[model samples]
Target: MRIRKKRSLLNQAAGGDGLRRVVRKAYGVFRREGLAGIKTRIAWLRAGAPGTVDPRRYGEWVRCFDQIDDATRAVIRERVANFENPPRISVVMPVYNPNPQWLAQAIESIRAQLYPHWELCIADDVSTDPAIRPLLDRHASADARIKVAFREKNGHISAASNTALGLATGAWVALFDHDDVLPEHALYCVADAIQRNPEIRMIYSDEDKIDESGKRREPYFKCDWNPDLFLSQNMFSHLGVFQKDLLDEVGGFREGYEGSQDYDLALRCAERAGGGAIHHIPRVLYHWRVHAESTASGTDAKPYAVVAGERALNDHLDRTGIRGTAEFELNGYRVRYALPDPAPLVSLIIPTRNEPELVRECIKSIVDKTTYRNFEIIVVDSGSGDPATLGSIASLEHDEVVRVLRDDRPFNFSAWCNSAIEASNGDIVGLIDNGIEVITPGWLSEMVSIALQPGVGAVGAKVLYPNDTVQHAGFALGLLGMAGRVHHHLPRGSFGYFGRASLRCTVSAVSAACMIVRKSVYRDTAGLNEKDTSMAFSDVDFCIRVREAGYRNVWTPYAELYHHESATRRDDSDLAMQARFDKEVQYMRTRWGSLLRDDPFYSPNLTFDEENFGLAWPPRVGALV
Candidate 1:
């Protein structure tokens, strides 16, 4: 390693050949370690911190080729063939003027599948390239399982995909791009998943990008059946297998949504499949080929694709009766839901005591910056003995929107919040910290829009620290005994863990600090446990209970705020406070033990020790129940 670095430095000093060598070496590291590894190496080269190239894993994703030895192939083949009910999967391909070499590889991938109970259904989309039809025909003639259909007219991807779907005679249909390659065990894995869960109607696997040189990179480790994540973007683009019945129900793919025809179909299929009916195989089954003309290379290759994606999302929202406008942003769709008719008033319940200046700033921001008009501020004053704080509360009583509720009892955060909820006339309740400063406009509106959604129980905003690092982006369970904030200290706009920090998605919990929940949902869970967790884990407990009551908790980066509180500077000196904290932590473990052990939205493959979505040292696997 020392010699390599010395050589790298010597190469850096020299011109042309030496520099190219250094670059190639760096690129080699990049290919092995991915973007995070490359970033670490760059930092080290820049004389930065001690973050060096991460030690390579024994059987990491890129080493998939090596892992698929003859022994592994034999095991897969045996497992697949031994399955009692092996569902026939029809591999559907919509061919265009793809590179002949790449197209051949794609076809061969299907041919090389370990699971033999499959057929290849090819639909030629009237490609002007004379070579495409003949190539497809020769392959079809050679293989009995391969079926070819030539389109009379030039239809786009949507029509072509539909034609291919029509040709499928299998129980399930697997989508395959013309230029993409599938792993040999891909069909076997899908079959195994179906065998394990007979109810599974839709299945998707993790995928990576393969460049022109056939080097795999940019592996996307996706979560299982995340509805909110799916709404944000089509996470399941490759190796998507759906039951033929579900495909027929959704009518394959829509004709006009050419670029995002698959996305449209997936959305429709999901609506029918339900969240539980979909299965995710956490393996790199598909390799999307990246070429100059491919969307995988860049969205700029086909800008119309972006427009089509937005249209698909909008149409999905409309069809699902969700009042929202989906806009194309950050290579994904951001849906800004329309406010309900005669917009239900939201009660901004803030608990504070003797912090006049802070309360004043908080109130001022709410009045000045809040875009949503229908809101009432309910300040749950906790025995404010100071004249300044009392006077501040008194002054706020004049405004029709502001209402001061005095609670001279013991300082119980959970109790205060519960009391405020009871007092609130509005349908929605917002539990905001006194120290939070509104950073984004329409913050309340965004929260309310999501909160009002049919099954959403609680909505949390992206809370950044004063230094602009993330304080909270929804709370993840099992991080610190009870829960920890997702992307806790990630820099602003960094898009931590596959854009999870930025996108509005489902989570097990969201922090009470700047959290919004429906009044009815709060009552359903009997609000927070004031006695057990007055200061800590109350919000986590409440959110979990809300989820347990069959509602989803959402966290949105759109509604941004700056949390003034520093979690690091927390004073544990007071023995009583420490004891209370310990008790609260214990209470959380006792109440929601299983939930704390596993968070569905946050994949188990991800690390819990660190907030960043780093690879788990020893990934957890479920025992056969």
Candidate 2:
């Protein structure tokens, strides 16, 4: 029988969508060939594996290959031969009834580390398997670096981890599962990061999974320290190393959060050591092992793990004084922040020309679907040539909360939005296009919650096309010269690279079609620039200025809206329109040239030619300063 692919198993485990799924189809492949099969597969991967989703990553690995060559190993040894202050890393391993074969592989991976300054602290939680205790004893006797402790009773994973933590004598402790494997240069990478940034207290690296056949796939190329994304899910699960002092300060891992103990510990550590103390090493250093009973195969392996994770997140929020509640959504969590008391009014501004049908739908969705009560609509109509549009505009006058203002000048989207802003009276303002329709009922509430957060300048919602394809998720600067949406045209319900399309991560900017900005922040940043009469890049310019004023612009997938984008606007195919667009693009390049070249939220290793989030042709090297 032909072997099944890893993706099929992942889809089955994730119920057709696997943001956190690990590869599990290699068991039969590994069993058939044994050790020879594992070696052959890795060799094939180095030779540019066909049908690989991320070929660039494999290509990079082939070049480096964790200093396997004698010459490369010598160079690495020379570099760290006489380090001034080398920090010892304590590997905390909590073991139960792990597969003997896989368990040996895990221990061997640590023994193969290039970095010499480390110790493996293993706590066996009373394994029923008779082979486990003898194996631990043999390894500890052979290697002085290996320390073993046998539990008197079968404590859960949290207690077992705490027991291992007690054995840690190093300044930093790194979490390692008994069944998982580590790269040869994992500790070396950690040491290098520490050498570069000595102040780092918490460090995490990107990771992937190894199938039973030793086929490495499904790499998660994560972003830098993303607090918003952390609240949603445990992005820093693998290769997490924390200062032992910081862990002690947080009182170690809580007992009840068994399956998600690492996530809970990470959150607690983050609460104590923030900003520069938190660091990210964007490289796959850990390889999770996926088996039938492993949590990597499915969350259902430990049903209570999901519940415990939610409780951990809620506790983090309460301790941090963030007024919100976290609830489970698929394989992740969605945080619903409680709206401020006497909710600040949000002025919804829509710029329209004639298109009566589009404008009507936009207004209807806002009135009927929006659940946020403290909001007023301001319609800025620009020279309605059709009498039907005039009637539609006059009809809204009867609604006391909706105000229809006129901009009799030529069609300039920026000027129209500015006019509406001046005429509106609300604590917050939303610049929405006339062709947008609300999809999520709690859209306004989600936007308001984020907008009202401290140091947040603007909040952008996920805008999808009428046919359920993504119109705009968030903007990445330097993409297509000025900026472009990260996951534009991606199918709905599909998460983009590393679940970035679904998670609430920060972006350089977001489209103003359905953006909410605080009135104070808008005034502080001087609102939208009206200089670009063609109206292109106006929203990007506004967001950049907002960030320059020391505020973060955020994009949330929770607040969703269907955007009939460009429905009312004239096509830029004509010579005159194309010339205006060129001018607008040129104006943006002139004003923010340096910023357009580099976007902090986006990684340098990613492609700028397209928004596919694929690895660049020549991946960036060295540490990000």
Every model: Cα RMSD to truth: 9.9, 9.3
Candidate 1 residue 265 Cα shift, in angstroms, is 0.9
The residue-by-residue lDDT of candidate 1 on 487-532, one tens digit each, is 8887765656656766788888888888998899989999988888
CA displacement after TM-score superposition, residue 256 of candidate 2 (Å) = 0.9
Q: lDDT per prediction?
A: 0.79, 0.80
Clashing pairs in 2: none
Q: What is the lDDT for 437 in model 2?
A: 88
Clash statistics: count for each candidate: 0, 0
Q: Candidate 2, overall lDDT? A: 0.80
